[model samples]
Target: MFRTLVQNVPAVADTSDTSDTSDTADVAVIGGGMSGMATALRLQSAGLSTVVLEAHGHAGGCAGYYRKRGFSFDVGATTLVDFAPGGVGAELLDSVGIAPLNAQELTGYRAHLPDREVVLHRDQSAWHAERLRMLGDSERHRRFWALLDRLAQTFWQASRAGVRLPVRGPADALHDLRAVGLSGVPLARHLNRTLGDALRSHSLRDDAALVGLLGMLVEDTVHTGVDDAPLINAALGVTIRGAGLSRHVGGMHGFWRALVTHYRGLGGRLRVGCQVSQVVGGPGHYRLTTRHSTLHARRVVCALPAARTAAICAGLPVATRLQTFLERDAQALGGACVVFLGVPEEEVAAQELTHHQLLQAYDRPLGEGNNMFVSVSASGDTLSAPPGHRAVMISTHTELSGWAGLDPAAYEQRKKEIGERLVGYARRAYPALGERAVIAQTGTPRSYQRFGFRPDGAVGGPRQRLGNTNQHAVPHDLGGPGLWLVGDSTWPGLGTVACVLGSRIVAEGMLREKGFAR
Candidate 1:
């Protein structure tokens, strides 16, 4: 059990005339995903005229949900971690004055490894006993875990205290200094290091079971394995269960509906089904052209992916770092394959845990159904399923290119094959998982590209190697004065919490750039 996410939404300050049809605002956020919406909400609350333009029919990008029959399937992300009080998501909700929707705080999930099953409990002592008893009980294991715990604590401190990246000014520098604190200052040394370095230091890098579990956590969170994931971030990722993983009552659907309502109630303009094809002009005033009209704004936050931003901002001055990131991750971007199933509750009745990560063979690489994450909606949660059924979503990391360049027949065949393969993998954990399902479908990289608007169907950020993440990750502030980027493609890359953190940084940066902050 965990603390609830029901807080009162404080009244938001009305910043602009909502009824104005001029398509002009003080700021224009290019996408309406989690990051874009959070940024625009904060800016609007701060009394800045802001508007959010989403290409999709509604918000929530990868976090978005869709319904088939009576089942609601989350498109990408399954849970919100570090979302309790004094956590990253808590700060964003508190800032926007929107109370979070009802959420079920996860106790933990069962990680079914080859050798044993480890329960990732949210409680400190339970998790300690579980990991040590399951992964390893030696001194080396203890030491590695101790280091990870310390690093995770340091990252959470910086996060909850409102850390911003790129250190835009003395103000930003001072904020980071205070947020990181003297006790945590030394931990910054871990930034350039990789999780492999930490594990090797403890002489536990060769522990296949331990490393495989880390790969499961980090690959899902930071989008990398133990060897390449940045030390500090991987630490946070591995410990997210401790920070708290909360699944909304209706999953992302309830969360987004409430958030969009809060934003609109605050008089912030949100234009759905509006795709901005070109962003021309900058250094103050800018013009965003969509099929409907050309919106004018003094500031523009290109919350789209790095590659898409590069494409649309042809006339505007794009940043060198952004282009560098686009090229660097063009072929390397990771996508996901998801299998959505709606089955009777009895199918999952044998499962004690609602969420599970199954790795059939630890020796096998993590992807293409080898490492599968299975999530079942809460029993009797009618918002996500029918009265006697539960919504099940199983997903795994995938190579985007594998799903590309195939003819129609080949593509359909490949999709069908992958879907069946994942369902087969899930059977090891939930024997009746997708049996007798009323609704079943598969989503591939091409599906993501079509529906999510991600370039080449890239899902999460880069593999989060030491070279491409942290300071080297794409900055929120592009070179142009009014230009900015926020999303999985940017710093603190990928995840619901990361997007909120990125939004906070961009909102603060924009306020300061517009002379609203000290």
Candidate 2:
């Protein structure tokens, strides 16, 4: 379907528009994260001249990587979901004609709770048996699991089939309904529900072990606790192990390098360190103001977080629209605390898998290192670290507000405490994780704000809730001509796979608007 979308469109033109307009293109992508890169490449392949303006010097916004002292660490998100054969990621790669990813297929990770360790296997039957053996084996447990498998299977397939959601109009409503098919009609009842609702229906709401496990998984994927996690969204979250989770052989560093190479090879323009400060004018005459220069494009796709998008498009009609959601997401916007360590391979080799999710205590609140995830690079992936060393990234969610208004001394003190706490928590999986680290550093919301250029360092979109996700999600078009939004902030929500799905929706819409498609 995508192979011929842009085959007849025109390529980028030579810019003789003077220093005032140093760059110009048929489409301009305002962020170089997964969503922006995907959309730009799709549009570029469709025959439109495209330029991607990234504030950061490198690619992959939250999913990006960094190097220090011969060690490379993924900044956020360790695994790629549903990228294997017939999955959304595979479809995207096929659509763009990029070679399939060289990722290490993972069996799954071990979840370390305060009292028990559960192995979440990728094999469906194995996971079914394991969950029954570990979490609960009652009929109610079976019913709950059955509901999740049903919803997850339904929606995951809809997404893979290119379902467009968060209906922006009558056309979208029809398109999405058809994409879902008649078989999925009954699943819509869950749209108004929460994961808690499902548990309640099964009379398992009080099951702390199960709730804690679900909470940890839900929070990581949807940025919300189980009670408030939208049912459909949570379904996809808890069952991702069954879908597939893989860490690139060289980690995100290798992933970004490959993506950028493919995009550039397609003749797409990538301007890093070029921050867009303002966007003015309208469709086919949009003006993007960057710190160093200005870029003009016929269309604009912003993959920025909502807050950053609001700031850059300050006075446009979309700014007001963005603000409404910004206020709704104000309390929901969260950040991350990451501890990157360059440790000896032995430290990580002791673990059964390269990834582990640790919940220090089921009763305690989730963040501030109580619940953390650890991702260690493959032992022989030399691109991530020195031959015998490995790069380890430990992350936990945090509300951005918690890190504000601190004195320098106080901030430093807190950063130390949280960083140490996370490292300590990670020890549950890799007992020797940080004992003899060659390099250890911590990052807070402020660190993300500084490096990722996100407003308040908001990492994921608003925590998925009944009112904030699914049919209520922020759509691609914000009532601005030629202005579009994609990324974690849009439909399908966070992670590599979600962003890629959003890219497909936005790219197709851009093409349709330009009459580049039927």
What are the models' TM-scores?
Answer: 0.94, 0.95
Best by TM-score: 2
What tens digits encode model 1's per-residue C-alpha lDDT throughout 1-518? 00001111112211222233447888899988888998999999898888898887677788887765656778888788777887888887788787765889999999988878889999999999998988889988888888888888888889877787756679778899899998999988888889999889988888889998998998898887788888998998898899999899877776777788888878788877678898888756788888767889988998888888888887666844567777777655899999989899899989777999988887888999878899999987898898999999999999877877999999999999999999998988888777799888898988788878888889877778877777677888874467878988888888888899899888877787744342
What are the lDDT scores of the predictions, listed in order?
Answer: 0.82, 0.84
What's the residue-level lDDT of 107 in candidate 2? Answer: 96
Clashes of each: 0, 1
Lowest lDDT sum, 10 consecutive residues, model 1, at 1-10
Model 2: CA > 4 A from native: 1-21, 514-518
Using alpha carbons, what is the TM-score of model 1?
0.94
Best by the lDDT measure: 2
